[model samples]
Target: MMKHGLDPGDRRRPERLTRPELTARREAMERFLHVATPQLDQLYNLVCLSGCNVLLTDAEGVVLDQRMSEADAAQFRDWGLWQGADWSEAVQGTNGIGTCLVEGRQVTIHRDEHFHTRNIGMSCMDAPIWGPDGKLLAALDVSSARADQTERYNRLISAQVAQTARAIEAVFFRASFPEARIVVASDEGGDAAMLLAVDKDDLAIGATRAARRALGLEREGAIRPRPAADLLGRDDDMSGFDKAERAAVTRALARAGGNVSAAARALGIGRATMYRRMARLGLGEKQP
Candidate 1:
């Protein structure tokens, strides 16, 4: 903070983005914003009675959208918690949304934990949201300026913020691959959004961060397209793969009206390979 020439006692804040700049940023993050706005609304509906404001900010910690009770709007706006406000750790110093974005995790900066004395009255809880590509995407925050709020209660709200962030990530991931099949890689650590997008050949097209780590898949850019079964370690047992393959071939054959050539084409495979697999799997004799 001192390096940024910030003096906690001075009570100064960074300049917020102008209307045009904010509009441009929103346009850049339109996809993420489109998916997260509705979640913030839902969260607000559940939290409105608690006298708090729910905010969604981009990776840079600039507030893109917010939901607050109209009764407290003027007060929160005065505290710089409104739309277009820049609360990055570099700008605001040791706050909830900004610090969580920087740390890439959940956090709560309660009351006097704020670097600036003017912000000491508010408590903020936050969680970092990751993009479909497994990069830092945004921050979800719930800020309460209510004087009677306690740190214990803030922790409860903190959990809600983190859950909402995961929901946003899952929605964004599914939206990113509308045509692909989404499969749950694991129920464990699913709060990290362990999801995978697979293609027609059962190749893993994309994976959420937790899914990527669990599967030992690609860390950046497009995945190299590994088989989902292989990633799940199910390939160690050919019995399972055979059973699944048998089912797939049977379905394709049925769909093709029992024509081997049509079934091979439908399965996106060569006729020779299809016949060989059918024989190995003890499938019925092939048609002429």
Candidate 2:
């Protein structure tokens, strides 16, 4: 079974961030909302479907825009929250968005993470959004009533919140620079070999600084255009590969449970070729 607090919504874990540690995150959130508008609205709507309240905060931990259930909205308003409310721990004490910003990782804080007694009825999960230069961009948070009987409901909402955060990131990335390929580099390890972002046309968009270094580029460059087979080591047998290579690699990796060697063998390719495919094609560490 999954640990309660290590990865997701764990209630049994030790407390992570102190009150003062959240100051910087709170400032960042203050700045993010100043510049984000229409897209922020879309993000709010995306999380609303999960029956959770979504908050868009800057690095500083201030609440910019909030979307909540009808009753919850009324309660929040009754609490005197307006458009410019600051929910940072320094101001409001520990909470999901605030703590995640301070911790700088994805986390789930069941009611207990809240510093205030009133907030204990909520379960909140959050992930930090990052910018192109890898600076903290914003905090995406989802909060729902913990009194609900179903753990599945909380899990579903948490997943939706995470997806919404990614969607906002994708939209922000594309909107900021429509021409730039938005390649996703893995958040873990900062590996030069992994490429995370892919364009709609199935082309690799951006490569991480580490990846650029591995690719032998002096400076950062585009995600690089290479056939799916080239990355997966099937390039040598071009005649045997076709448009389905991407889908094939994806499914193979999934079936192999993320074992690249198994995926390669299943595809009749050497393990080395599989590695090349992972890097060249920009597949990150994820099994999918």
Candidate 3:
């Protein structure tokens, strides 16, 4: 709170968005809201069943969408935890949404952890949502007025919120790159949520957060539109040469509409060589 220039003991109510300001903010997030609403609704239903409220907020912590029963909404409105409220660290101090945005990670602000006295009654967990380009897009948060006042419970809720946020991010990433081929890569003996969007030439155009992490891509948007083989550690693999050969053949075939002769010409290989490589790679020519 001090870094954002707020005293921990500050007792003033946070600023609220005006009617026009709220509408404008919502409009700015229209694309994200549209892509995320279906999954958000599913998560909201599950959380509401447990008497919790789920909300979607932009990167700046402006609430875009919220889900809660009318009764619950009414009771929570007194704390300004509704739609159009600004929960940025600059405004709300160290609450879940605000802290998550600042840290760029999942967080749980339980009870007295909130810097504001008014927010002390609320316990909330939040996860950061990232776009296909690995940019922070928004935050997904679940809060409850009657939350379990236990550290273990807060940790459980934090994990749930993080998982929910990852699911939403995956859906958004796939939707954002509908025509790109999605490749799922996992660590040995472990399931991975990372999804790489590859082009016909097997060039990576985008990736999920998990994919970026697995590939050790530190710079944002740096791995995108690069050779997937290069970024995915194919150079050190035993079958790297064969895999590259197969990828080239597959790309040429796809680009030529599966016409063997055309694909061969595009790849600068004779028809016989194309046929031999295609047979080896298990690709069949399409009749044209």
Candidate 4:
């Protein structure tokens, strides 16, 4: 920060957005707040009595929402932990919120680890929240100015911050594709959520970053729509299962004299599902 002319000894607080500027900034976060605000409340209740403050920031690290104990309000404001404060690494230097956004990972800047000498008394743990497209969206931070807080305690709190961040990312991802079915790709991947959004036809419409990487697709944009089974290496048109299904459907239709509903009932499947299967198998159109 010295190269950028920021002095470690400087005690000035980060710049606060003007009233109108803050208002506009918040209005921009309406959708994000829809998914994050409630979770932040739950997290706040779990940690507020511990003398900590929870701050939610936009991708640029501008504080967008926060929850703090009223009793500790004065000191938190004095430290500039409030709505409109810009804590981007450009201004704050090596802090939890900014660094997490930059690194795309969870981070903890403990007391004395802060770049600004003035901020050295507070401990901050933050995790990056990812958007549906695998881009950095925002940060979730838990900061404590308590004198008795220790590194050991920060580790435990850090896990909560990370978990909540993932929860926000998952919810946002699902909301991004409401019409699709979200499938858990696997349970073994460590924090990075492995999920896939499959449409009604079983095509892969979207995937979480971890799943995209595992499936060898682009990480942050429109994935060329493909059969989920194809991507999973199960798209064998000539496989025994496909042949068997085609034969079964063909025989059911023949037995029912081309009546689709009767064929579906004989196959013990719903009419719509049976129609879909027949269409998928390229079977000739039959009467409903």
- In model 1, how large is the Cα lDDT of residue 85? 90
RMSD of each: 3.9, 15.1, 4.7, 5.8
* Model 3 Cα lDDT, one tens digit per residue, 195-216: 8888776788888877888877
lDDT of 2: 0.58
For candidate 3, the lDDT comes to 0.80
Candidate that scores best on TM-score? 1
Which should have the higher TM-score, number 1 or number 4?
1
lDDT of 2 by residue, 154-181 (tens): 6766666666665555555555455654
TM-score of model number 2:
0.51
Worst 10 residues of 3 by lDDT: 184-193
Please identify model 1 stretches exceeding 4 Å from their true place.
Answer: 187-189, 236-247, 253-279, 282-288
| 25-53: candidate 4 lDDT, tens digit per residue | 88887887898888899998888888999
List candidate 4 stretches off by more than 4 Å: 187-192, 233-288
Which is the better candidate, 3 or 4, if ranked by TM-score? 4
Writing each residue's lDDT as its tens digit, candidate 1 over 175-279 gives 999999998888565454889999887888999887887778777568888878878665543586686788799989999998999999999999988998898
